[model samples]
Target chain A: MTDITALSEEQILEKLLGGNEIVFEQVFNKYHSSMQSVAYAIAGPIIADEVVQEAWVSALKALPKFEGRSSLKSWLIRIVANEAKTRRRKENRSVSLEAIQDSWSTDPRFSENSQWKNPSSQWHGDTPEELLSAEELKNCIEKSMLKLPENQLAALRLRDSGGLSMDELCNILEVSSSNVRVLLHRARDKVLKVIDHFQITGEC
Target chain B: MLPNCKQMAELASKNLDTPLTGMAWLKRKIHMLMCKHCSRYSDQIKLSSKTVSTLDLDLPINEDVKKNVEKTYQELHCRKDVSQ
Candidate 1:
């Protein structure tokens, strides 16, 4: 009944290398979602699962050579990102950066003068925990997230969920720092609006 | 010139990713002080970002995929053992 979380990186690496099933499952559960997000961001949803699986195979094959240059999670994410990118190229799927429209100028919440026409209402639950406590609201947010533009969704997932640096995001997404900021903002804004609407009306 | 409410909202989101400094920081501070709506919007965006970051967006790993990966892990180690 060892607590895997209490184990150091070296210890975890040792367990992984030794083919410890418990440690392996624990590590997999902890990072699978983030890996999937990175995969989805790069390779598109249709092939994201395949990309993650391939990345895992590659990672396991190369695990013995892991030098701990970065955290295990970061290393795994990098592997998945690379796998996804390669798959994207093979599929001839290019991320449509041009389709992301900056609707901020015409956003109905503001007037022609850029003043607040429909200012944000005070939310009942302020903290992240409180907001996600309701199952319906959580579903709404997830749905809204799924509807975001591909690049924006990728930027948001990589930067927020994957805990990647902005520079790393730029490198992975093949966009400039300014473009990354725009994508991140647009994605976050959509989530904010979804929450706002949910708060005002008890619907998703 | 101080940014309008719309610009303030955008800046607020950007500031969360990277802190605002210099004139941008000062402008945001002053605008937030004078505009309660923009202030609330900023707080909401921050909360949403925090929530999204903490969310477990992962669907359960498919059983087939899990089994295949596990099998691959074992085969990899078995090959290493043979090589040694």
Candidate 2:
């Protein structure tokens, strides 16, 4: 029904807890895409599928303990994040999220920067060939990213890719805020050099 | 207007997802209008962010995946918590 479609997630949660599997399915359908995106964003495409699966399991198990302490979606997402971490651990990898227990703290903007450009700044390169060629460029950069030290790779991915704040990066990576920023800047510098080399020399 | 350069940059990144506001945003906009190099840096940073965020990882969820996910969800009803 349109009314049910318009129901708040809270209402859905109530139905789910009331033992309505159909209502729970609704929640699953609603979040499935977003949940997968977040997991994939953190762990790459390979494990993201498994992560979401485990998250569903975990969410179902954790539901009884949720205690209505947060938004339904938020609680479910926390489980999703945990599942992503679990997948990372199983793979012996933690590229983007270092670990949630790190003591790093930061003021978000990082060390900060000056200036800005016109809002219209776009990354488009000239020529359809150039656009088509960017796939190669991304590969070149990805290869370079693999050469980075573990911490730097994690920091860069978390900051630039995950869009995590310094505080979040610190929490995820278990590092200091200052260290996170420093790691990010250094990693970025290296990536920039690699990208430049690829563009100029066309070599990986 | 906001506070410091670092704060502005941080806010700028955050604003990438949202909106700019307050004295800091206004001041940063002013600084941007006057500075080309910083603007370029910001743009580059943003572009790089997109590149890293999106990195060769996006794939459409084909029907097989949808079926597997649904099957998994159903099987979840068969077990208790194993997340410990």
Candidate 3:
């Protein structure tokens, strides 16, 4: 849709800081997808896109205050990261780390094949469904994720879902490696609680 | 019912990850040996996560946003506020 081919990070920064709208436009078109990946990796597709747009405005507004200490690409990405974190905070949703230890029986995401636990039925006929219905946990997880503590959710999305390493997550989160792991553990716990809570209520 | 309702229930929860283990694993083994509710709950959670993950979701960007982006740039870019 938007014609964003490519430009070195420096050139892109020049256009954006220069307030050249045309160059700005190109930069946006170029990085939007990558930004979405980061956003979605940090949150989800819905919030990712929004974070991208908001990051643009925030970066633009902050341009005058920009110091030439860092690369523009990294700086812009940090803006996006901050925006996504803020969005998650506003929503107040988060995935609980307890998912590992909690029961997701009620959440529709893990429905159907408890049979795997059935030693007798392991040899039974007609295989039951394997995966949980995404629709079932649709709004629940996303909403919960938004409510999670910013550090925890960001850790989960960036590392577990986004495939970022612990080091990378630490870099992105601007925290110590150990701190990132702690946040991730806590966040996962919260998600489990949500799923388990749903099971307790028989929603699963 | 399982021996430890809370513990088993907690263990029964693991459908959230791949090859779910740890506390959940102990929960399953304990429940399977003695408890029924926990076993069922665990089964249910696994089924739910699997079902949930399989769901096909297409969350689209707002149409108005696209229109606004295109329209604003087209209109604003075309105009320059100058001393008249």
CAPRI level of candidate 2? incorrect
Q: Locate the minimum summed-lDDT window of 10 residues in model 3 chain A.
A: A119-128
User: Which pairs clash (backbone N, Cα, C closer than 3 Å) in model 2?
Assistant: A98-A172, A98-A173, A99-A172, A102-A174, A109-B10, A111-B6, A112-B6, A116-B39, A117-B39, B2-B24
lDDT of 2 by residue, A1-204 (tens): 333477876676566556665665567666665566556655667877777777777777666567766556556555666567666777787554343223223323233243222222333553334433667777677677666665676566555554555666666555576566656655664565455456566666
Worst 10 residues of 1 chain A by lDDT: A96-105
The deviation in Å at residue A40 for candidate 3 is 2.6
Q: Chain B TM-score for each model?
A: 0.80, 0.50, 0.48
Identify the candidate with maximal TM-score.
1
**Selected candidate, larger DockQ, 1 vs 2:** 1
For each candidate, what TM-score against the reference? Answer: 0.89, 0.49, 0.40
Residue A86 displacement (Å), model 2 = 2.5
Candidate 3 backbone clash number: 55
Which one wins by DockQ: 1 or 3?
A: 1
- Sort the predicted structures by TM-score, highest score first: 1, 2, 3
Badly placed stretches (over 4 Å) of model 3 are: A1-10, A17-19, A98-176, A179-204, B1-81
On TM-score, the stronger of 1 and 2 is 1
lDDT of 1 by residue, A130-189 (tens): 988888999898888777888888888877776778888888788888888888888999
